[model samples]
Structures are given as structure tokens and as C-alpha cells.
Target chain A: MHNQIFEKYTKADKSSLIPLLQEVQAIYGYLPEDALTDVSEYVKLPLSRVYGVATFYNQFRMSPLGENVIRVCRGTACHVKNSSNLLFALEDALNIKAGETTRDKKFTIELVNCIGACSIAPVITVNDDYFGRITTKDIPSIVKKYAGKTKTNGVTVTEEAV
Target chain B: MVELTINKIKVKAEDNMTILDAAKSVGITVPTLCHLKDLVPSGACRICSVEVEGFRNLVPSCAYPVSEGLVVETNSPRVRRARKTIVELLVEDHPQDCLVCVRNKNCELQDLAERYSLREHRFHGESKEHSIDISSASMERDPGKCILCGRCVRVCNEVQKIGAIDFTNRGFKSIVTTPYDKGLNVSDCILCVQCIVVCPTAALRERSSMKEVSSALESRTKFAVAQIAPAVRATLGEEYHLPLGTDVTGKLVTGLKRLGFKKVFDTNFAADLTIWEEANELIHRLVNNEPVPMFTSCCPGWVKFLEHNYPDLIQHLSSCKSPHEMEGAVLKTYYAKKLGISPKDVFVVSIMPCTVKKFEASRPELTEEKLQDVDAVLTTRELVRFFNVAGIDFADLNDSEFDNPLGESTGAAAIFGTSGGVMEAALRTAYFTLTGENLETMELNAVRGTDGVKETIIKIGDKELHVAVVNGIGNVREILDQVREGRSHYQFVEVMACPGGCINGGGQPIHQKTDKVLQRMRALYEIDKKMLKRRSHENESIKTLYKEFFIEPGSHVSHEILHTHYHSRKK
Candidate 1:
């Protein structure tokens, strides 16, 4: 599947590079190990520097992404509202600590500071959407929403248990 | 001349003129607090910040010079916001006692606050609370009210030539104080009171003489006589909304008359008398070879400067009280005898243009028979306040002359108000008295005008006389420094604490940002130019007084009354 995506990505148009790279990372869950080198040479940057730039930013990843990104706000207002407890719950339920993708690659959890909707805090963001007044108990269902979703062609598939 | 555009308006200004001056030349008003005309511009206050097109930050327009083709904005939104923020920050920690402050209505900071429409402090923070230090008998220092503008420090160091006070510490902890926070009276301070005059806030103020004068006025039993200093006439008009350097001598006499004084005597008469005694003493010193260099004693600031800083040179200073003090002493004794009144019942009040005169008048050494020479010394500002209280319209008052005997003065007496004036006045009498030949020109143009220290060599008969004139105390320091190094070539020197001399003394009427000290000094010289008799020796009144009363200059009676001694002070 990785080879197939690499071949198709090589033939892909240069004008669509940013979006295609983003799309490929979205489909496969993250930029694959070889994608950076291939993209670097295609764009004429040294592979090492490109990898360095990719790793420097928190937004980029070399491994496949989980099915969902769960961001818990630890902003001043949210931190006071027990957001830490919700982060712990999500960490325990996923069986992987905060900042790590789940074993089944279904969810990735992270904490952010003050996302500006501080008025509705104890807030969490799943991808682009925000969930306010979140509790520890809501972690399972939040992860379950993207667990059984169909995988697109040239995308990674990983098995999940319960 | 350099042409510069300020706020899109092009203006021509002389070379070496600052952008603020250029802006002012073209009627572009920029507010400032620490910029005084006679003193060096320290630019401590950032209120005059203006936007120069290429500069990274707002620059102080008062200190920044204009360059060709430079575009400047005086009142742009950015400049206004920066100025407002700077003022707000200053006001945040500033004492909020404008109504009760001594400079209440006259304060530049308060006026700026009104101009900026600052109704509230947006950035209130911890204010440094300092106790009032009134250790000096002459002036009071309220650190609680100091804006830390360094005008006092500059005036003390640069203008007065005395470095008694300086900015100690750094940043927010900085303060203007004597060394080791010692009281001014304990420091090598000369008690010039020039600091009090230049201070923007009420931080430094002259000790109050209002109550003393008020009580004197209320006590109808004593016969009160007021003497006006020559400089007072040159600057007193400013108190009555008169222009800078307005010669309101006639009106000032009228106002004093309206203030209910029994007689308004002219200190100029005594100024002429001072020249006679001082010149005679200088000639005597030169002839007897007693103290080769004789310093003029007409300026109390210079006398105090000698006592405090150059104590070793005290002998070099002529033992003469200032004209004001001399007039005060004479008023109580000679005038009292003439009127057949007891000296105890005669009140001698002097209206002077110097705050230091207040300190001078109260000097222990100036007392005669345990009675103070001058009972009260009112600055020109205080006299104006007195006039206002008495509802006297100085401008509308009918022109009147000072009373006889003591009222008549020569042009030499008139020029005493300006820098180098006393020296010129003295020279006119001294050269003639020594050679018995009249001076070719009454105007001694070389010693006249507003240079910091003017040195000249004149051919007095067969002798080449060396003379140095130091107007501001700041200039005095340089000359003294040279003297201390044994490099002083001057046989005679005249030093006035204030720049441009007593006409610009600290006790003179306050010049609201627009008028400056140098302008007032020039106005004094102009008045001197218009006078008929510019030579002190030529004044008929002075000659008559010499023959009738004192017998001669430096006579035993004159020495007992007019000459004074000074003491060395500890730091």
C-alpha cells in the first residue's frame, strides 16, 4: 500500500504538492517514512533538511496518524476546570499515554493552551470541531466515532480490539 | 540656514537649531519640560517626542537636529499616542497634588496634563514616596514632587557652575540629591536657589517670605520702605502678563506705592554705590598688592560659590555685600537717620529678581547691631503676587519715579541686572577714579551681552587690566577650575549664578515655556542702552552721597557698613 501511494504521489502534479502531501498524510494518517525523502527530491530540498524541517514543527509526523486527533485545552481557564482529569482518562482508556497515538491507531491525544473559546472551557477539540464541558467518561464514545470508518485507497489499515 | 519640513510645512531655521526649534519657528508646537533656553538640553522628558520618517522610534524633537530633506510629523496619531503614553506613565507615578502644589497653577507638568486631556492614569503603579527635605535655610526640597527631569542638576552643574546636586542611582531608583543623600545645607551647596527657579515641579522652592511681608504690611506702627533691584524691573512685568524683558520700572514703583509702602527706593542707587566701593577696593587691592584678583561681590550666588567650593579663594572676593543687601542696610540706618525715625521702627524690604538674595539678606554676617539688614526679601514673583493681592494693575498704573536720594541711578546701575554688567559698571568708575580721565565710550561693548564667560584685556591708562566675566555658575566652575590650576590670568572677575545674570535669576517672574532666560537678558541690555548715564561714577546722586554721607569709597564708615565677610562651609 505504501509503495502504491508513493508511485501515485510521484506522478501527482507539482501545483497540488502542499494539498496532496496534506491529503496523503490525512489518508495514511501521517506522512510515511519514505514520503519526506521522495517529496524533498521532487521539490529539490536535501532529504535530511526536509526531514529536519518536518520534525521541527509539531504539525508534521513521519509515522501513520491515528484515526482521530483529540486535543485537550490546558489553557489558564480550562486547566482550572479539571481538564487534566479528562486528559488522564483519555490516556488510560486509549491504553497509551498523552502525546502518543493509540496501539490500534484510532486516536492521538494532546494538550493545548488557551484556544480562545475559554468562555466554554474544560474544552477539547476533535480534529476541527470543539467539544466543551467534556468529562473523563466521554473519552470512549469520542474515540469510537472514527473507529469503524472505511479506509480510502492508498491509505493504511490497522486492526483494533474492542 | 537650514530648511526642514515639519508636519508637511516647510520652514527655514538657522543651522545648529534643533528640530523642536525649527518646529517652533514655523509655529509647530511641541511640548517640553526639561528644555530651558539658557541651560543645556538634557532631553530627560520624552513629552516632545516626534515621528521622523526613517527613525525606528520616536525622537525627542527638542534635542534632535533637523537634516535636509527630512520629513517630520509633530502631531500624528503615532506621535500623539506615544506622547500620551509617556505622559501617562509619568503621571502614573507622579504625585497627584496639583491643586495643593506650590507650582500649582504654574507647573509645566500640570499644564501638559491639561493640554493632553489626561483625566485618568491608565497605568497606575507604585510611586516612590520621598519625604520633604527642607534642610537648607534658603530653599526647600520636596523629593516627593521631583519629576527627575534633571533641570536642577543641569542648572546646578552647567548654569550655576556648582555640582552640589546630581542624579544618583539608576532607572526608577534614581533621584536628584546631594552626595550621600546629605542635606543641601550640609553639602558644598552655595544656596544660589537657581535650582528652585529651573525646577519644573515644586520639588525645590524658596523658603516662604510671604508671611513676613504680610505681617510687615499689617504692622502699621513701623515705617516700611521698599527697594527694587534693577533686574526686578526687567522681569517683574512678566508677573503682570507683561512680555519678557519688559522694562516696567515706572510701573513697578507705582505698584510698590500701591502696596502701601512708605517709600519705593531703587537698589540701582546702591548698585552704583556698590561699584564705587567695589572698584575702589579693587584699585586698592591692585595698588597695595593685597589679593591680586578681586572678585565682584554684587552677586550673592558668586559669594556663596566662593565660600562653598573655593574657600581658599575667599580672600580674592571683594568684601562687599550685594547692592540689595547694601541698600537694605543703608535704608535702616542712613535713611532712618534722615527721617529722624528709630532704626528699629524702620522696615527695609527689598524686592529682588534673585532667590539667592533672600538667602543673602538673611545672612548672619549682614546683620548690623543684631538687626537684619533687609527685614524681608521678596522675589519678583512674590512682589507680583503681592501686587495682585493689592489689586494693582501694573500696566495701567501711572508712571512714577523712585523716591529721592536713593532712587536716582546711573546706566551702570541699570546694567547690573545683566551678565558682565557689574564688571562693566565697576570698570567705568574704577578706571576713571584711578586715572581721573573719562572713558571714551560709556557703553563698554566688550563686557556686555550673554556669553557664558567673557574674558577681555582693556588698556586702563598705562596698565593692561585683565578681566573675566562669568554669568552662569556653570561657567564659574570652568573659570574656577582654571584658577585652581594656577592658570587664571584674570585680575578681576564677575560671576552671576544665573545665566544672563540677575535679570534671569531664579526669583524672577516665571517664563511659561514660550519666553526664555536669554531673551530676558537681551531685554535688560536694551534697557541699559536707552539710559542716559551709563557710567556709575558719573551718576550725580552717587557722587553727592559719597561726599556728604560716606565721604569716599572704601572710607572707614563705608567699610563698616557695606563690606562683608564669608565663611567656609562643610560638605
Candidate 2:
């Protein structure tokens, strides 16, 4: 399955590593350890080096992605606008820290540099839906909105998050 | 040619040379922390930062290219301040237990601090707490002492071509580690300790067997017997401040005896025995038209490297235990039986120049009846430390001979320390086996060199044997790939994981000069040249052993006692 993603890249062509990783990430939602090993073999780079590259970049994650990715922008504008409080509020609601998924895998709190909407200052994006200028009080209700349901195979599945 | 002015002294150097090399041409020594000789400059640690007249910022001389009419000041006020500050900052976070550190005086970071007169840690706040990884039986990782020089990384990735560790994370959180920050034992590490060789500080070191050996020596019921590898003799002299290439064989035996070993043997004896088994195995493969290329199985690191990476070609490896393992096996079985002592009571200690030998000693595959072939292994460095702690002055030591039977070895065994020595040794015996006589000239100059790979052909009887000698583990990949692809032309291949073989093994005394390794290589050849018995087949002791116990080479009993198989370590 991972071989299809490596079809465009030449064997031992290290320049294609990032794109290949991106493709793998795109399909798998995150970089799998076995896929990374395959990539290491395909690119003729050591697994340690591939892993180093993966861990260095914030975009690539080692674990499987949760049902919903809650990206909290910690950029200069968002940080100055007290975005940390919003993040702490989200963490309190989800009971999971940034760069970690909830026990039920319902939501993943990711501390991103920017969401590219600085006009709002503090911003939190759950999936494609943006919650701009949100305060600590708004976190629990926003989380609860996506807390009960999940999407399975691109269809809205009405079921408990667990 | 590029002209560069270093400290106002104009000098002409090669156009491709870096500013560091250009400065060195004029006798201006620019100190560097991350510059490894012959490897790509990492410039990770900017200790070699120097002032260039036109540049706004100080350039790292190690990575900076030397250009025409470039003006450089190696030790200007600005450069000195920068270098001092770099040293001071590194020392600030580094462990302050240098007095009790493994590389106290030998550490490059410690030397840099001393050179810059860093009497105090100027910068202090939060120091990163890193737990030492002692999971590997051979190598240790002390992240607290690591200066992030990346020398070990380069040696592992570029030299050995085994990237078991790399620069992970980013910035202050950066560390050279295995994938997922896993311990080296679980990682794809071959336990070669080549990384330990290049590491500037105590961040990397061999897992010492000193305590085990000490206790074993003091055991009332146990008979502690020490066997010294051929390579250890050539390099061990460096610890005593002896001149390069000095063979400390006789004194080494004396030291081992002084260390309370009941008997001190020579691993060279088993090295000859390795040839006895390996040469015959090669002939067996050749006669039967089995695998064409039979790789030498002496270097434990090389064996593990093959097992890890080239598992498909495991059949090409000779079914022979490494020399030290063979010595340990024979000592436990044949020698113990001869001495009327139980194998359980015999505590075998191997003094090897290679760190991987420690891991090899602990291997379950190499054991018989749950008894590890060797009980303990101490590298030359560890043995040096052991001697120091025991207050034995090396310089004042007298010459002594190794104990009989297993101690006696031919001159061919002495050269087993170097890269091509095994192949050369095997050829001598193989020739003798094929044709009922030995070659006129013993030295196969084609295989002898410091080159990463050496290819040659030799005529034995009616057959022409094609052989290749790989000095470094990095160079073996291309050769093995050919073999895997069925494009390999050679019938015999010898690989020593450490560049230039066990003489420059990771466990040898550390020195900045590469020439010391060459000198040690020369010393092994000298030992081979001086000995009366030059061929493994000519060893009277080996002949007696064959007659009394093993019967003949490649015998079922010999296979059971001396030979072992390789298995795939790849997941």
C-alpha cells in the first residue's frame, strides 16, 4: 500500500523524501513506523535520518490522527492575543495536552504556529470549521459540538465518540 | 591554487581546501570541535569560527571554502572571544563531573575549555537532564556529557554507513539518537562502537567488563584465563606512551598475569585455528560449487552488520566463530578437559581491541550448553583503565610469554589484527591445502593497504581465486549489493568493520592522528615478518590439537566446537 505513494519517486532519490513523506502522511493521516522503514529503504537513507526529518518538521506526526484535529494557532499575533488560555481551556475540556490525542481519539489538540487568519488574533480550527477570537468559556461548547459524533469514510456517522 | 592570508601570513593551498585546511598549511592551527578528518565538515559546533576581513560575521573555517585573496585571522580578538564563549557555553551545560568521567583528560571539550582558560561556567540556568542509555552490552550513551559535535554521527553515517543514530528534534532539544529515541540495543546498531571512537567526550564509551573480570579473577573456585587479541598488542602500547607501531605482546602477557589471571593465552592461536576452519570451509564451498564468495567471519561487528543489513547473503559468511570466541570455546572444552577442571569453573576473559567483542562474548548463538564462549571481554582502553586502577605501571613491566597449548600461534595469526590480514592468512593456508606446498612469498601486497576496499586475484594450484578485502563497513555495501544481484566476480571477501581493521578498532587507545592506525597496521606486519612459523598449517601446536582432539579441519567435531552459523537480524 505504501509502494503506491513511492511510485513517482526514484529509488535512492533523497530529494523526493519530503514529498514522499507528505504523500504517505496524506494517505495514512500520519507517518506509520513501518511506512517510514519502507521510505528509508526506498530513499536509501537510514531510518534514523528519516525519523530525524519527520520529528524536525511539525507537520509530520508519528502517531495516527484522531477523528478531529483541533489546530490552535500559537503564532506571534495569536500568542499576544492570549491564545494560550484558549489552548489551556481546550485541553481542560478534552483532557488531552497539545500534540496529543484524547483517550477516545475523538479529538487531537495540535499547537500550530499559524492558522493564517491573524485578523481574529486567537483562532482554533476543528476540521475545516474555524472558531475565531474564542475565549476560555467558548472552548467546552465548541468541543462538545464535535464531541458526540464522528465521520467514518467521509460520511457523518451518528454514534457515540467512544 | 587559492591564496589565503591566515593571521597575516599568506599561504597557497589547494582550491578545494577549506579555510581550516588552508590555515593549517601555514602552521596556523585553528581548533575545531566538529571537524572530522576526511569527512564532510558538519560545522555544528562553531569553535573554528574565524574572522574574514569582508564578512560581517565570523565564518566557521571548517566549512568555509578557501578562495583567492581571502584574508583570514585565526586568533584575532573577535575570534578568540567567540571561541572562548563557545567553549564556555558548552561547559556551562556539560556535566561538571569531569574528575570522575571516563574521558576526563582525553575529552576534546575538556581540552577546549582548558585551552580557552574557562576557569568558571559563566552561563548557568537550566541544564538538560538526559538519562544514560546502558541497554547495549557493548556501547554506552551518556547524553549529559554529549557536546553535539556530530563526529560520532558522521563516523556512524558516513564512515560506517550505519546510521543507527542521528540528530533528532531541533535546537536546544536536539540529540543524536536512534529512531524514536530508542535504546541502541533495540535499534539497528551493530554495536561496532565506531561512534564511540569518534565521539569527542565520555558521551560514548564501551560498557566496561572490569568489575566482572575483577570479581571473576578473585573467585576461589574459578580459573581466570585471559586471552589477548593480536591487534591489542599493536595499539595497547599507545596507552603507555610508547612509540607508534610498538608491539607490546610480551609485556601485555605479563600485565595479564599481573592482573591475577591464572593463565594468559593468545587469541592469535585461535586466529590461526580460524584459518584452519575458514580456509577449509572456503575450499569445501569452492569444490562443491556452493556460494562463490565466502566472507571472513572474524570481525564480530562485520558479522553483525551482515546479519542486520545483508541477511540474504548470510550463507556467504564462513561458519566459523571469531578468533576470541574460538579461543574461549577451546579453553572451556579442550583445555579445561586437559587440565582436569570443569568448564563451569573456567572464567575466560578476552582482551580484544574491538568493542563489539564484548557483545560477541554475550551472544547466545555463539554459546554451547548455555555457556557463553567467552565470559567477559575488555577492550584495550578498558584493560588500560583496569591496569591503572590496579596501580600496575606499564612502563616498568617485564616481558613474559603466553601459557602453552592455546597460547602458541603462527605468524599469520599476528596479522589478523589488520584489515586484509585474515584474507592473506587464509590464502596462505588455502594454498597449502590445495597444493601440497606453501607459496614462495607470504606477503600478498595487493590485499595489504589502508584503502577501504582492495581487490586482487591469487593462483592456487590450477584455480585462480578472486578475492576482495573491505577495510571499512561503509565500503561493504556496494560489494554486497553486487553479490545480492549475482554480479559479484570474487570468490572470497574479507571485511573488517572498523576502518583498517582491529588495529584502528573502536576499543583502541584514542588519538587525533590517523597515522597511528597505519603504524599499528605496520606493527602487525612486522610481527608476522619476524616470526619463524608464518603459516597456520605449520603450527605444531595446532597439529597436536588436531591430532589429540579435533581429528582434522572441517571434521564434525571441529564444526561442533569451532564453527557457528549466522542468522538474519533484520526485522
Candidate 3:
């Protein structure tokens, strides 16, 4: 999809390549290696310098994203609510820690500070949707919903996991 | 000067001055804690927040750049609200023990609480409870009262260049501590106490010597002699509301006498003695083709720094003990014998402008006949407290002289209180001793002043003497790095752990702004410039002592009594 977009965008001035690459990354959720070559060819910037800028800022993601992205609120409000324990539980259930995607690419977890909603603290956002009043015990079943599975305990995995 | 307006009052300020400075020039007082003049402005404490006409939100006046036609409201409702909110937030987590804290009456936070009428805390939560670490011989650390102002971090890293302590964690849980929360005694901490001086709260304090001094005085079994450091004379008057740089030597002597000290001596005399030994040692090193750069050992902080971080360079350190401790050792030995009193009967006390001197006095090596060289160490501030306790009005006390031979000193001895002064003093003696000719100019101007790191080369006779002077630990790191890289240009380096030397030491009276401290430092240099006997060897008493007793400088007898060794600290 990025290659197709890059090929279509290359008709314009080469300087527009950075914006195009950023847009592609934003859509695809990570900057692929082929995208860097495409960016260097289209923008006329050194590949190393472009890669340097990409790595310098924490905002840019380099690897592929998991099917489900779990962002645990580690903000002061949530932290006081034992969000660190909730974070540990989520990491265990997903079989991957924060900032890492699972081996099967099924789930990824990230810790973030206040998303500005402190009322329902110890909160987790699954794929850009909020899940409030989350407990450590709720982590395993919640993660199973993203993998399209159900448990023997009759805990129904909601279709809309968020 | 750039013209600026604050709250409708126009003021002229130097170009590049901050709005806070401009406001201050116009007699407007802005509350601040982390801003020290000599130190780089760390906009950590938002107490100095002010409203600017064009800016949307309140900005820290301490760091905000002043501009032409700029309008600043120092105490507008919005500014007050922001300042109050910041102060309240800081107070929320702050330990509520101001009445019992060491800095109860003198703390910046306590003053702010009084200024803002903060009787009760609106926000309450679990406060940080860090166990107080008093393991370091020189200073104590109380993390519970830390405001996270970063003054100590800035002074240590940016000014001293030591980077011994830094902000370890993040946000509310963040703390200033050595890497891995290691005790300071075990870390590469120099025991400079520069951190103690800059800390706004009781988070850092010098270990007290008041009890020991009081006990000794009360006993009356021992003959107590109190020696005042050279720097103390320059700034001790400030605590009594005397003007900056007012000479308080006579009053200091009188106060010590009133405090039950049998004899009041001068540390300047020992400083002159230090010059004689250190200069002779430096020349000896040059002649023997030994370690080219002989480090000045007068600063305990610098001595500890070399012990911990640069133990390999220990051989380069001049073997002379600091004038304060050197006097203590001599008083217990030589003075004891002269007065026909047993060493046990003589209690040697030092009133210094440094907290590290307390640590230096505690070192087991500086002992004679199983008694410590210095029985008690009192900071300049502590001495002032003693004066107040004794009801001795410093201003009312008539000018008097220090007791006998130990009381006399040269101008070179006086400047030992400031950074680079020891190097300059040593050079004045060393150059004359080597060439056997009086120096045309006594002041070694190149090595003077308060630059963090300064270097100069002088052609003395046949040798081109390469020298470096560093005031703060941060500067020491850069110089040490150069030496480690085998590219150092200096043949001799003098390092003082405080930014402006002893005058601005960790034990000195705390100034709210860095500018005021710099002003005081400048006043000290001015006092140095006006002194009659500007060279250490030129002092009559020092010459007589050398001729009659020690025989010559750096002799075996002098070295045994005056010089010492360094130890490597496990990091």
C-alpha cells in the first residue's frame, strides 16, 4: 500500500517525499525499510540522515504493529491506582512487554501518561478505544478478545474489545 | 544598558539580563529558590513565575529574556495564582517538619510559607519518605525535604563539573541521588558540601560540631584555641548585617574570646605556612624532575576529589594540609609544647568557611597523641550563631588583635579563602625562592578571579610554568579528562570544589540569588587587592617561624607535621 502511494506521489516535487513517507507510516503504523529507500530516492536526502531523524524522535515506529495495540495509562492518577501492577499483568497475558509486539504479532503494549481522562484511572486503551475500571485479573480475557478466542470459564470475548 | 518596564516602572538593565533581574533592579522582589548568580539558571522551581503582557501563560522571571518595550507584572493576580499554585504543589509533597528541620528558621521554603501566608496544606498525599543518609563524614542527605530544585545538581555538574549527583527517577517519584542510590561515602563524592550550600531545604546539611565545641568549653579541663579561616574574615560580618566585604577579623577574634576560647588565633598564619611548604615542594618537584604539577591540598573537597576520582594523580597533590587543619595539628603539637601544656590539655578548634573542613578534621590521619588534630569545626554561620547565643554584638565589639605569633598573616593568607588564591600565593613564593629575586609585582593576576576553569603560563627564570586553576568540580572533570586523554596543557593545576572558592563554600551563608553571591565574591577580590602584604613569604611571623623553628620550608620536620596523604574511595 505504501509502495503504491509512493509511486503515485512521486509525480509531484521530490521535496514532498518526506510528507508522503510520514503519511504512509501513519497509515501503516511503522516505517518499513523499503519506504526508506523510496524516501531517499524521491526526496534526494541521504538514507542515513533520514534514518537518523526517524530514530531520533520517540514518535516514529520502525517495526510492524501487532493486531491489537494496548496502551496502559501510567500517569500519576493511574500510577497511584497501582497501574504498574496492571501493566505487569497485561504484559504477561499478551506474552510481550510494553514497547514490544508478541511473537505471533497478535498484541503490543505501550505505557503512557495521562490521556486526560483521570476519572476512570488505571485505564487501558485497546486499538484507540478506552477500557475503564480495568483490574489485573481482567487482562487475560481482554487480550483473548483481540486473538478472536474464548475461554472455558464462559467469559464471552466481546467482538468490540475496546 | 537595555531599558525595560516592569509594572509601569521603567528600569535600565544590562543587555541579555532576565526580566527577574530587571524587576529586581527596579526594587521589585520576586520569590525564587533555584536561581544562584554564579550558577546557570535552572528554571526548576516555578516560584519566580510572572505575567508578561504579551505571553499567554506565566513564565519564570528568572529565565525569561528581557526585551525592549517589555511589560512585566511581577505580582499580578494571575502571576500570584500561578506562583501560589506552584508553591502549594511543592508544599504538598514537602515534609511538614519545618519547625524541627535544621534550617527551620533559615530555609527558603519556610520564608515562602510565611510570605504567602500558607497556614495549611490544601493538597495532601503520601510524601516521599527517604531514609536520611548521614554516612558521609562531611555532610548529611535528607531526601524527604528535597524540592527537586536541581541547584545541587547544577552546582555539582554544571559549575563543579563533578556530575557526582543527578536527578535519578522521573516526575513525582524523581529524586536527586548518586547513581543506583549508592551512599555518598561510597560514591565518587568529593565531600565538597557545595551541594549542602545550594540545597534550599534541610535535604542537605553539614554534620554539626556545635555540641563538641560546647562540651569542650564547658569542661574547662582543656585550654581551647579557636582559629578563624581567612575567608571567614571577609564575609562573617554579613550575618550581623555588616556590609559585604567588611573586615570582621577583630570582632571575630573578640567573639572567639567571649566563647570561652583561651586563645583566638588566625588561620591566615597557617595559610602562610602552607604557602612556604607548598611552594618549596613545587620547586623541589621541578628541580628533581618528579611530578610536574603539584596540586594545592588546602581544599579538603579537592583533596577528597583526587582521592576518589583521580587517585592516580595523588602523587601530584602538594602534601600541605589546608591552613585550617594545619593550624589545628600545629596547635596540638608545637603550640602545646611552647605553652608547656600537655597535648591532651589543648583543644584545637577551627572556624572555617567550609563544611568539608569538618570532614577533614575527622580524618584519622590528622591526629597526634591519639587526639584529633582539630577538636571541633565550626562554619562561619555557626560562629555567628555562637555570637548570637553569647549575646556578643559583633558591631559593638572594639577592634582587637589575634593572640601572638599564630594570629599574624599576609594578604596572600587572606585570599586563600577564594579560589585560585592558593596557586597564586604559592607562585609568588616559588618564583622568588627559585630565582632569589623579589617579584616586581606581587599579584599573580592571571590565577585570580572566579572563572570556573582558568589557565595561564608564566616565564619564571628559565622555566615556563604552565598552571591551571579550577573553582568548581564540573571544571575539575574537564581538566581531569584532558589529563586522562594525555593532552593536558597544564604543568600545575589548582582545584577548589566550590564555584567561587571558600567565600561561596557550602558552609557560607545562603544567598537567595546567584548575583548577590557573585557580588560578595567580587567584594572579596577587592579586599585582596587593597592588602599591604600581598605575598605569603613577605609575612614577618612566617619568616621568623621558618628561621627559628622549622629551619626551612619542606624540611622533614615540617613535612611530618604539616603534610599528609590521600586515599582512593571505592566507587
DockQ of each candidate, alpha-carbon based? 0.01, 0.80, 0.04
Identify the runs in model 2 with alpha carbons over 4 angstroms from their true place.
A10-12, A151-162
Residue A65, model 1: lDDT of 57
Instruction: Write model 3 residue lDDT over B39-93, tens digit each, in one string.
Output: 5677878899988887888888899888778888888888887777778888888
**Quality class of the docking in candidate 3, CAPRI style:** incorrect
User: Could you give candidate 3's per-residue lDDT for residues A44-109 as a string of tens digits?
Assistant: 543443554555445667788787777899899999888999898987776677889989887778
Cα lDDT tens digits, model 2, B1-571, are 9787888888999989999989887788899888999888888789999999989999999999989999999898999999999999888888899889889889898889889898765888778678999999998998888888988888998989999999888888888889988888888898888888888899999898888998998889999999999999998888888999899998898988888999999999999999999999999999999997999989888999888988999999999999999999999889999999999999999999888888888888888778988999999999999889889998788999989998899999999999999999999999999998988888999999899899898987667989999999999999999999999999999999988999888899987886887899999999999999999998889999999999999999998989998788898
Ranking by TM-score: 2, 3, 1
Candidate number achieving the greatest TM-score relative to the actual structure = 2
What is the lDDT of every predicted structure here? 0.78, 0.89, 0.78
Number of the top candidate by DockQ? Answer: 2
Instruction: Kindly give the stretch of ten consecutive residues in candidate 2 chain B with the minimal lDDT sum.
Output: B120-129
Q: What TM-score does chain A of model 3 get?
A: 0.76
lDDT of 2 by residue, A61-142 (tens): 9998789888899999999999999888888888888999988889999988887988876888887777787778787787
- Per-model TM-score on C-alpha atoms: 0.73, 0.96, 0.76
What lDDT score goes with residue B309 in model 2? 86
User: After aligning candidate 2 to the native by TM-score, how far in Å is the CA of B554 from where it should be?
Assistant: 1.0
The predicted structure with the larger DockQ, 1 or 3, is 3
DockQ of 1: 0.01
Candidate 3 ranges with C-alpha deviation above 4 Å: A1-162, B1-5, B9-17, B38-42, B67-71, B482-489, B513-534, B538-540, B543-549
Output the number of the lDDT-best candidate: 2
